[model samples]
Structures are given as C-alpha cells and as structure tokens.
Target: MVRERKYLGAETNAPVSIICNCCCKRCARKRQRRCLPPEIIFNILLHLPALVIRDVMRHVCREWNLMIRSPYFIHHHLRNSIGGIIIQPLFLAGKSTYVVMRRGCLEISEFDCGFAYAIRTSCNGLTLIPDSRDIYTLYVINPLMKQRTALPPFPHTVDIHSEFKLAFVEASMEYKVVNARGPKPLNPPKQIAMLTIGVDRVWRHIDVQHLPLTARTALTTFPLVTGGYVHWIGETFVLTLSAETETFCEFPMPQLERGFRKFLPMDGNLSVVYCSNELSRDVWEMDSETGEWTMLLSFDLKPLLHRFKDLFSNEKSVTYLGWLAVREVLVLSTICFQRHCIAYNVKTGEIQSFELGTDCSNTKPKVYNFVAHKNSLVCLEGGF
Candidate 1:
C-alpha cells in the first residue's frame, strides 16, 4: 500500500502539496505531486554552509530542526563543510584579542574567562583550555556556543610543570586530553594520564614502562592531530599517542640546524616546517602509516630577507605559525626586536603582513598558533 506525501512550511500549517505514487501510474495528471527520498534531501542540505544551516535553516520547520539536530546530519555537514581559521579565539591563552578569519573575512571578538587560563589545543572548532585557578583542571569549550564542560581533576598531582596534549579523534568521535607530568622537586608522577571527553571523567594512566617518556618542549607547544594520533614535538623525535588505543609511538624528525622546527596540521596529514638550510625553508609531509616524509615545497627567503632587512634582521631566522590552505598562503613570523608576521602566497609569491591590532604591544610577541577547523553543527551534549 502506498501513502500520500504532504508538505508543510513552518509559517503555514496547511499542506502545500500531496503526492500519491500508486495513483501516478493510474492517472498521468496525478503525477503533479512528487516525493523526494530522505537521502536526497540530506544531500541537498549538505551543500549549504554550516552557519546558514544553524542560524537560518533549522528554524524553517520542525522536520528540518530534527534533521539538523541529528548526529548523522551533523557529521555529514562537517565532512562537507569548508574549513576556516580562527586566530586566538581563546583569549584566556593570551592577553591579545581574538580574531577569527572565516570565509575570507576577519572578525574580531572578545573572550572573558573571568580567571587566568590557557588554551592547550583546538580540534573541530572545540578547544581544550586549562583553568589557572586549579592545578589540574581542564575544560572542553566551544567558544562560539558559549558552552563548556569541565573535566575532572587529575588523579595525581600536576603543577605548572606538567604538559597537556589534546586532540579530537574522527574515528572514535571523541576528544582526548593527556596530562604528561614532569619530574619536579616534589613527588613526581610516574605514569601519564589520559582522559576522553564525554566518556570518562577520570584519567586513565598509560603504561610507559617499556617506552620511556621524556620532556621535549613546554606545555606552550600544542600537539598536532593527524592520522588518528596526537603528535608532540619531542626532544629528538616526534611523540605520538593513538587516539583510540591510548598508546604511544616515536618517530624521528629530519635534522635541522640554526633554526627552530614547528609541526602543524595540513591537508589531513602532519606537516613539518623548518629551515632545511640557511637560505631556504622547506615544508614536509609525513605518512603516518609508513613513516615516510615527502617534501612538498621549498621557498627561498634570502631575497625577501634583503628587501626587508629591518624585519628580518637575521637571514636564516623564520618560523612557521600555520598554513592557510584555502588561500594558498603560509603564515610566517620573523625573529627581530618587534615580531613581524606575514602570509606568503606559495602560488603567486605575494606577501601581506597581518597586525594584531594597536593593543598587541602590551602582550608578549610570539607566533600565534592556528588550527584548521570547519564551522560545524556538532552539539556539546551529544559527545560528537
């Protein structure tokens, strides 16, 4: 038996159309009304921007509201959404103001955390921030939604010396934060603890007896999420933690002299940016499965350095802060008396400087950390 399909708008209660599939075969005129499959409707909705869907489309009708609220729909929307860059959205991490660059436009906003805090990392538009009010308190926050979830305190003692790593797992659809305690004057933690947001409130210790843990950098260095693992710049190797298994792995990094190295997420792979030599900078991508490294591109900065000697005081000093893939530009910062940041277009060789506004002088000048994220319809309550 076939049933009639009815269409209703949110503003209007009366059915706009009715379609009976069985009668269409009996009478050609009855084919005026047609019905679309749910899959087809979902596909059509995926083409819309996430902001539009969340802000406007959801209010169109009750059926649309339910469709937008579904986790499946949210994930599909995220999969199809174009990524954006949010610069320093978590203001608690620094004294500088928040600036978000989305859809080729810059928007500035204010963040009031009420207390001292710092951002650990951001994944899928959600950031991991730690509250300075407590020694080991962490919060998973969606700054856009003004929603936050406080993580339980670390079972062991952690101080300012502890290092925190955060990443979002696409496979498991969960966010994981690791607290790697450092050896200190007091009782030091023997094992590193890991916790998955929305699943466990308590931290689970990872057994690293066979694999020794070492401190490579400060907590200020954020982790890069790629290939189902969170990567941290280690002393002489890249430290990786599996998002699902909560295990650890180590991989060697290319040797570079006279300059610093930075790791960033690019094109769903882990990217390494550093000076391959004194006159040139190189960007390399790594295959997480096979542990293979491929050089993507090399840029000669010697001529650019000569042109702007004041900004680039030293010829070999260049640091990569982030990659804007959509714009085909790389965000680079020079080491000088006053920090200068510029976006260098890889394709066109065009360079443009970005300022952090007039109030940036009061805060410490450092390379701003950027994460590639897409505006998503993911809800804070659902664990996606």
Candidate 2:
C-alpha cells in the first residue's frame, strides 16, 4: 500500500512494470478470441500434412467417412502417386478368356467411353484395337469398372476384302485406326484409310502415290520418347509414321527372318525377337538414335527342350512364344502343340515348365500372356 503519485498528465497507483514483446495489441486481442479447444486445435494441426490427414480422418471414425470418400481426395492421391494398372481381357486360343497385364496401376480417378473400340481414361488414358472387323457396331467394355461404350459406324466406305489395324498414340493425344483395303491401280497398288481421334469425320483415304507397297503390311503403333509413332511392315520393308506430323517415313529392318520376326518393347527399348528354327530364338535391339539393329541374346532350344521333354516333344515345333523381362532377366514362354506353356530364363538359363492342363471344366490353360507386377506374376490364358 503506497501513496498515489502524479507525473506529467498521468497518475500511477501501483508499482511500474515494463513488458517487452513483439506482438501488437490487436494481435493479442485476436488470439484470445480465436483460441480453440485442445482436441479441435490438434485436429486442425494434423491436416497440415496431406497423408496424415487422409490416414487419420479416413480411419478415425464414421463422422469423417464423407471426407475420405470425396472425389477430390481420390484425385489428389492418384495424381501425386505412381499410377494404376490396366489389364486386357482377351480370349486365348484355348477357348478361355484371360486378362493380360499391360502396365502398372494407373492413377485414374474416372474414365468414359466415346467409341466402342476404345475407352478413354480420365487422365488421358485410351486403348484402341484396330483390326476389329465390326467397327460400326463394335463395343468396348471395361471389366474393372463395368463400363461400356458403343461407337457409330465408320463413315468411310469399308472394303470388306482388306484387313485393318488400330493404335492409340499417347503423346499426340491421337487415336488412329488405319484400314488398308484392296490394292489400288497406278498408285503402287496400296489403299489406305485413317481416322483421327477428336475429329468428327470418317476415315479419309490416303493417296499412296509414292509410298512403297512393301511398307504397308502389318500396321502397328508404339510410344516413342519424343511422341508416339506407327510402324508398318510389308513383305521386307518397314515404315514408321509420326503421330505429331501425321506423315510416314521409311525405316529399315534387321534383315534377319524378316517374314516371321515379331516386334515388342523390352526394357524401355524397341526390340525384335526372331526365331531361326523351332529351337532357336534371337533378340535384336533397335537403335532409336541411329536406326541400327543390335543383337542382344541368342538362345539354343536344344538344352531347354531336352530338360523339359514332357512339355516339348519336338523342339522344331517350338513357335514364337511371348516374352517379358522381369528385373534384369528375360522370361520366354513357348507353347508346344498348344498343350503346355514352358518358361525360360535368359539370364541364369533356367527352364521351368507349367503344364497347360486339358481339363475342360477348368478352362484350357494356355499361357496367353504373363506380366510381373511388383512381386507377383499374373498370367493371361487364352487361345490366340
């Protein structure tokens, strides 16, 4: 208890004290009114990290159920993560249908079908198969999502006598379906038709005025670093078409077994696997930079056939089997007489045979396709 002192124009009744701080008077006043409860404050702080928010809220309780199920969450998670997987449901040669794993899981949030021949994913996902005969009435179904889309008949005049091919180019965001009809006169005897995605016109005919006839046999498309391109092989010639330019350019083949060689992608590179005889498989790599062919591996079928005689009776009858690279090892699967599926490891040179049982009720076990996902091996069993 002290006597009050008057200084200048102010009066002090208690001991004088100084409070040092950087916060303004208004900020301190706002902090008092905005202070939340401990639990509520903790919840708000947890949402600072996206994953933490998802795991905590999604798995917390039923009240946060709606928050986890929102499309925004799904899209965000997928876009920031590695992607999704796509499997192709195909009927194999054994009267059974199997799904072939194409790639890893995709981060697609949604998808829709515009034409029957293809389904477009939300994030620019599209799959097209051109050789489908029933183009106009063809229907595409996504077994995963149970979605189907039917396409209108192609507007161009279809020559029923010729074969067709289809492909989807991701880089150019174009869907091209090329139909090569009967031979044309005075034009190298080659007829061509094409359809571009997002374009509302039927396939237009291309004049093969100077295009070689030997460059239009099996039309196929593949993805390139720059963009996606189409490769067409006829007789002994090969041609590549750039989706960006929509023009065709001639390419060279390895000159080895040009008739029966098969094209495939291997280890992020374009490769060709050719069989000299039933018991021999040769793999060649394509030099994307210089357009050169390099031999990768050559395998002799004698050892593998001898070790798995139960699966392969005649080594000469070993047809071109599907191949996939697992880790650093290349796995080759071959079917003999359409009865057994034999797998071969190119690195360690190990042979493992999986019998394609002939149980009618169990579905013929033809190794239609096989894909390695993470640590699991998914096989597609079908006829052809």
Candidate 3:
C-alpha cells in the first residue's frame, strides 16, 4: 500500500524531496520534520561498537573529530572495557611511561621519584611509590586520576633493614603492610611489631613472649574473595591472621627445597616462588581450603641463562618477583635483576616480553615492579 509522505511544514507542502534510500517512505516524514544533525549522528555512532563506529563515521564529517578526542569519550570507552596497564620507566627521561587503556594508551603525569619501587590499587584509585623508607610517611595515590590519601604510619618501630609487603583485605576493607625482620633472639624476645590500615590509631606494638622467630622470615597479606588474610613466614613456620577475626593462627609451610622464598597473590590464592635444588625456578599455590601447597609451574632457568647470558649474569638480575593476572594472562615482574618483565598465558603457556627504559632513546631495557587492581594496571618503574 502506498502512503502519502509527511513533511516538516505540511500545510502547503509540495512533493517531499527524496534525498537518499535512508529517507524511505516511513522515515521520509521524520527526516523532513527534523533532519539528522552532526551532533545527533555522532551520538548515535558512539553507541555502536568501537570498530564499527570508527569505520562508518570516518567519512561522516569533521565535527566527530573533536568529539571523539574529547576526554569524556576517551574515559567512557576506557571505563567500559578492560583498560590498559601502565608502567613508568625508571632512569630514562625522553621516553615517557605509558598506560594502555581501551580507548588508547596515555602517559602518566610526571613525578620526581626516579623510579617507582611499588605500585598498588584501591577502590579509590592506584598508588605508586619509589621505595619503602619510613612507613610512617608513605602516601597512597592514583596517578591517572590524580587522587591521593596519606597512609597512616606503622604502629611500631620497624627495622629499616627488613623488606615489607602489602595487601588489601576485602572483608574488612582495610590495607595491611607486613614487615619481616631478624631471626628470633637466642634469649626471650620482648616485643613484636605489626601495622594495620584504616584503623583510627597508628601501629601498636605487641609483646612477643610466645612468638618464635626464625632465621629467614617473610610477611605478606593476601586478599581472598571471602576475606583477606595476613601471613608471617618464619624459617619453618607460617602464621596467618584472619582479617575478619583479626586473630593469628599457625600453619606449616610446604616442605620444599627452599633456598630463598618470594610470595605473591594470584587468583585469590597465595603463590610462593623459590629456587629448587636443581637450580630451577618453581612456583606453588596454597589451597586455602585444604591448606596444602600445589606446584603450579616449574621452569629450567638454565635455558634462560644461556639465552640471556648478559641479563642472567648481571649482578642486578631480579631475585624477587610477583605475578598479576590480566585478562586471563599472568604478567610477571622482578626486582633483583635489571627490569625484566614477561607475561604468560596460563592456559597456552605462551610467553611475551616487556621492555622498560628510562627514555625513548635508551635501547637497553630496565626493570620495574607492577601490580594489578580492579580497573587498572600499575607498575613501579625501575629496579628496586
């Protein structure tokens, strides 16, 4: 059936002009009544998939050029997709550090810290630090969003020599920093130090009449989906603190041939990395349910040593490392050696490399540290 066309001003309208096929009989009236302007067209294109929208609107007009470049559009795209992971290069100047977001990648605002030693993410945003110095003075920050909050200092006097690790416990929604120091005293030890975040007060010292320290100790906090927990690694013992109860309990470390140990959080589970007697690298995951350790990945460093002789032999070769799961892939970074970065697809076992340099001109890669958060990837630029 043929229907009469409607026009914007129809009282005395002559035959409506047929401009294009898009202006079919039904749409002809609406088109005549209100022609689609560039703004409307741009908005409609924004709702489409990125590739499809780009392909169709590339020839649409000039107005979209500015709209697409606008921060609103950029942020909208970034927030909707798995945004980019950003790593700031340490020691270089010209080559700026960058972040990879869905819309595209961008550089982080410049800071005076030579290289970031640690990176973290929170509900508020991301935080980067050059090193662990006075725990009392550290501040958490989100570089991309330019937001920051001064973290409360540790409660007790911490040994400046010991290394520290941080984790966020979701159950309590609090952040905790754990420091591992000297072995237990031959004589009875008098005091023990611990730190907690989001507490109204600073760190508080507890008497250690019952706690036994060992030759090699480690402190780490893990964020489990149900709740977060903190662990203290002694030479042969493991102490776990439940975030919900704020109580500590003892557990045993797997009897593995451990020379040196490193800890990381992976897939809501605790991961331990160490060098075996075979001088190969081995990774283990802790099963919270059974409290048993399961070996995940073992690699022959001998092959890597031969291939990257210069890197492996360097005194700066990274010793301590952590892994972050990004889009079903595991990204690893080290601190002992010069900045060495690698990623592995857990399922496929495919490996990729990341290069970090101080400046754009530095062909030699440097090392850095990295951490993943809810919405962003953060890396500490430079060797620690």
Q: Which candidate ranks first by lDDT, i.e. highest?
A: 1
RMSD of 2: 13.7
Q: Model 3, range 1-384, lDDT digits (tens) per residue?
A: 334666532765544453224357668677657867766765565555443434555445566655654545544543443423444443333333333322222223333223234343332134434334544365555454344455555544443422334555555545555443423423333544446654645645555445554412233222222115555556665666554455556667888764767776554466776767444567778754345778787755444445556556631354533343432344444445435555544445555655555445556556443443433212122100
Flag the better candidate by lDDT, 1 or 2: 1
What candidate 1 gets wrong by more than 4 Å, as runs, is 1-49, 89-116, 132-136, 182-189, 212-223, 255-260, 302-310, 336-340, 360-374
lDDT of 3: 0.47
lDDT of 1 at 342: 69
Clashes of each: 0, 17, 15
Q: How do these models rank on TM-score, best leading?
A: 1, 3, 2
Q: Quote each prediction's TM-score.
A: 0.73, 0.53, 0.54
Candidate 1, 107-145: lDDT as tens digits: 444544333554545566566666667646677777655
Question: Using lDDT as the measure, what is the rank order of every candidate, best first?
Answer: 1, 3, 2
Model 3, TM vs. native:
0.54
Better of 2 and 3 by TM-score: 3
The alpha-carbon deviation from the true structure for residue 279 of candidate 3, after best TM-score superposition, in angstroms, is: 6.9
lDDT of 2 by residue, 1-384 (tens): 334345422542434221112234667878768966645744453333333444465566554545444444433432333222221112332332121222321111222222323321112122332235564343323232233344345555444312333344545535555544534322333446666644635557676556654554334222222114445554554566554556777767777753457665442235676777766777787654345678888777788777866655775455543343322234334442444544456655765544443556656444343321111100111100
